[model samples]
Target chain A: EAGVVQSPRYKIIEKKQPVAFWCNPISGHNTLYWYRQNLGQGPELLIRYENEEAVDDSQLPKDRFSAERLKGVDSTLKIQPAELGDSAVYLCASSLDLGRNTEAFFGQGTRLTVV
Target chain B: SQQGEEDPQALSIQEGENATMNCSYKTSINNLQWYRQNSGRGLVHLILIRSNEREKHSGRLRVTLDTSKKSSSLLITASRAADTASYFCATDSNTPLVFGKGTRLSVIA
Candidate 1:
């Protein structure tokens, strides 16, 4: 089966501009996740979805960051008026079922560069 | 806040040597997983150990979990130059999966 897919392997935008990343989870997967990884650091969970319901998103910055997993298959993460600090890799992952006790399949990720 | 923290932020070893990495979390978890990431690439799942389990081996990879100490260790035997990458430990709970800062391993050929 095809693994998780993400669009725009790399993106470059000026600071204060809006940017969005897209993700398509694996087939039959019931869980999706969005994470941000900075240089020399591990990925930080931005949001998680159990189908259409966002089960965990407390770490998301509500002021500028927004995410939506429509139809429980594809997801989009948007950052409005992004800052220079927003430059990083945005990763999407998926699992077969249940949130815990499962290994996640990851996408190539979209590397965003905010100047 | 419930994220795992990996010890020895970075490690360098010669090819054919063994490299071990550790991860410690603050809370209980349903399972712990190890992932590897190449430079500027996505991550690949290595292995997972459930809370009720203690050790698991996959090829050259060996994982050990100690719930009593809330820590896990990953051992890679006969390391190769291709093993130069970052290794991360993720803890699973009722909350979202959170990854540790990761340990960069550089294996010299």
Candidate 2:
């Protein structure tokens, strides 16, 4: 089976411009997550989706960052008027379901460079 | 915000040597997991140890969880050059898995 898939492996955009990243979780996976990993740092949770419902998105910057999981399979994360600090890797992951013992599968991630 | 914190931000060892990484988390967790990420690639699951379990091994990888100390350790024996990567520890408690700043391991051949 194919793993979680993410598009635009690398993206470069000017500051103040808008950029979007897309993710398609593994087939039959009910739980998906979006994470941001800055250089030299671990991935941080940006949002999480259980099917089509976004159950945890408190960490997402509402002013500039927005995400949606339409149809409960593919997810999109958007950054409007991007800032230089927004340059990082945006990762998507999925699991069979949300639980304590299950492991997550990750995508290659989209490396966004805000210049 | 991140919960788990990995010790020894970086490590360097010769091939065939053993590599050990430690992680400490704040809150209680139902399970702890270790992941490896090669440069410019995605994170891959290495192993998972449940709270009720103390030790588990997979191939050359050994994972031990200590719920009382809220810490875990990952041991990779007979490391190879291919083992060079960033290792991260994650915790789950019915919530989205939270990761720690990873420990970069360099296994020189």
Candidate 3:
């Protein structure tokens, strides 16, 4: 089966502009996650979805960052009025279910550069 | 704040040698997983060890978890150049997985 898929592997935009990233998880997967990774650092969870419901999104920056999983099969992460500090890799991951033991598979990620 | 921390931020070794990476975490965890990420790529799951499990192996990869010490170690035997990548350890409790800074391993051929 194909792994998780993400579009626009690389994106460059000016500060104060808006950017969006898309993710398509593996078939039959019921859980999806969005994470951000700064250079030389590990990924930090921004939001998590179990089906169409966002179970955890406390880490997301409400002022500029927004995410949605309308159909529960795919997701979109958007950042409006992007700032210079918002430049980082946005990673999307999925798992078979919300089970604690299930392993999550990740996409290639979209590298967003804000200048 | 990050819950886990990996030691020896970077390592370099020749092919056919063994590579070992260690991870230490604060707070209790239900399970710990190891993942490998090539430069500019997404992470790939390597192995997962439960809190009650001591050791598990998958082909050339071996993982050991010590819940009492709140630490885990990954061993790759007879390493090859293809094994060069950043290895991250993630700890999961009742919440989402928390990752460490990761260790970058370079297996020179």
Candidate 4:
């Protein structure tokens, strides 16, 4: 079985430009997540979805960041008018559910560089 | 706010030696999991220890959790160069799993 997959392993864009990242989760997984990791910090959850419903997304920056999981199998994270501070690795993961015992599979991540 | 933090930001050890990394979290957790990341690649799940459990072993990896201390430790015995990577501990609750800063381990051959 294939693991979680992400597009554009690396991305570079100028500030104020819009950028988007895509993710395709493992088959049969019921939960998906978007996380941002800075240079020396751990990943911070940006949003989480169970099927077509976004169960958690309080950490997402509503002003510039938006995410959607139309069918719940694939997700897209978008940042409009990106800022330098938006540069980081965006990781996507999936699990059977949000259960504590479920192990999440991660993608290589899309590293974004905003100049 | 982040919930977990790993200690000893970096560690260097020789092959065949033992490497231990620690993690502490602020709130109650249903389970704690350890993951390893090589270079800039995705993370691989190493082990998971449930709150009802205190210890778990997977090959050369061992994880111990203390709910009262709100801490967990990962021990890699007889480490090899292949073990060189960043180790992160994630705490799971009803909320999303929160990861720690991670401990970078370098195993010299």
Chain A TM-score compared with the true chain A, each model in order: 0.97, 0.98, 0.98, 0.98
Against the hidden true structure, what lDDT does model 1 obtain? 0.93
lDDT of 3 by residue, B1-109 (tens): 4678998799999999999999999999988999999999999999988888999999999999988899999999999999999999988886757789999999999
TM-scores for the candidates: 0.97, 0.98, 0.98, 0.98
Q: Chain A TM-score for model 3, please? A: 0.98
Per-residue accuracy of model 1 over B5-24 as CA lDDT, tens digit each: 99899999999999999999
Looking at chain B only, the TM-scores across the models are 0.97, 0.97, 0.97, 0.97
Off by over 4 Å in 2: none
**Candidate 4, position B61, lDDT:** 90
**Winner on lDDT (1 vs 4):** 1
Off by over 4 Å in 1: none
The lDDT values for all models are 0.93, 0.94, 0.93, 0.92
User: Positional deviation of B70 in candidate 4, in angstroms?
Assistant: 0.8
- Model 2 scores a TM of 0.98
lDDT of 2 by residue, A19-99 (tens): 999999999999999999999999999999999999999899999999999989999999998999999999999999894
lDDT of 2 by residue, B26-77 (tens): 9999899999999999999999899999999999999999999999999999
Give the best candidate by lDDT.
2
Query: Residue B18: error of model 4 in Å?
Result: 0.2
Write one digit per residue (lDDT tens) for candidate 1, span A58-96: 899999999998888899999998999999999999998
Two-chain DockQ for each candidate model = 0.75, 0.86, 0.74, 0.80
Q: Which residue pairs clash within candidate 4?
A: none
